[model samples]
Target: MTSPITTLTLDGLETVYDRLAQAIDRAGEDKRALFLVKLALLNAQALGDAELFQQQMEKALLNL
Candidate 1:
């Protein structure tokens, strides 16, 4: 019983993860870590996982 928007968001997240992985491979470890943090946040928001979202935000801040 997933909505169209939800389905689209999941697909978008997959695409974003793929692109981020490629970018990380081309760049450096730090950049890859940052992208991963971002991906986690986006995933949390999309799935209404507030605890994960906050944890990811904290991790991202620590990285910065």
Candidate 2:
């Protein structure tokens, strides 16, 4: 017997990523620290870089 195949949506993922990137770009430098931290966390999860994500979070917190 063959198992069912699941499909993923690239368009939706692209849309979300684009929005996040745009948000990061639009944020002011002072406000960007937090935004960057959040982006870094997401990037870490997506790219498997926990250390970098944690570093970004710490930097953001320090800036705050």
Candidate 3:
């Protein structure tokens, strides 16, 4: 069975956004894409649901 996704609080989201921005900066322009792909793959593996990950990816693509 698929587990319900946990929603992050506003404060938690802000913290994560800040950390992600910092990490992207550290990854540098030359390798930021690679860094993000690696991060996404790791997160997807942890999530343990490829279908859910694909759905999330689709949601993320909206309004971008």
Best by lDDT: 3
Q: lDDT per residue, candidate 1, 1-64, as tens digits?
A: 3323333488898997798678779767767777766766677767676765587578868946
| Residue-wise C-alpha lDDT for candidate 2, range 5-55, written one tens digit per residue | 344499987998798778978997788999876866676666565565577
Each prediction's whole-model lDDT (CA): 0.69, 0.71, 0.96
For candidate 1, the lDDT comes to 0.69
Better of 1 and 2 by TM-score: 1
Give residue 30's error in model 3 in angstroms: 0.3
Badly placed stretches (over 4 Å) of model 2 are: 1-8, 36-64
Indicate which candidate wins on TM-score.
Answer: 3
Sorted on TM-score, best first, the list reads 3, 1, 2
Model 3 bad stretches (over 4 Å): 1-4
Candidate 1, residue 26: how far the Cα is off, in Å: 4.2
Q: After superposition, how far is residue 23 of candidate 3 from its true place, in Å?
A: 0.2
lDDT value, candidate 2, whole model: 0.71
- In order of appearance, the predictions have TM-scores of 0.39, 0.38, 0.92
Error of 2 at 39 (Å): 7.7
Which is better, 1 or 3, measured by TM-score?
3
lDDT comparison, 1 vs 3, better candidate: 3
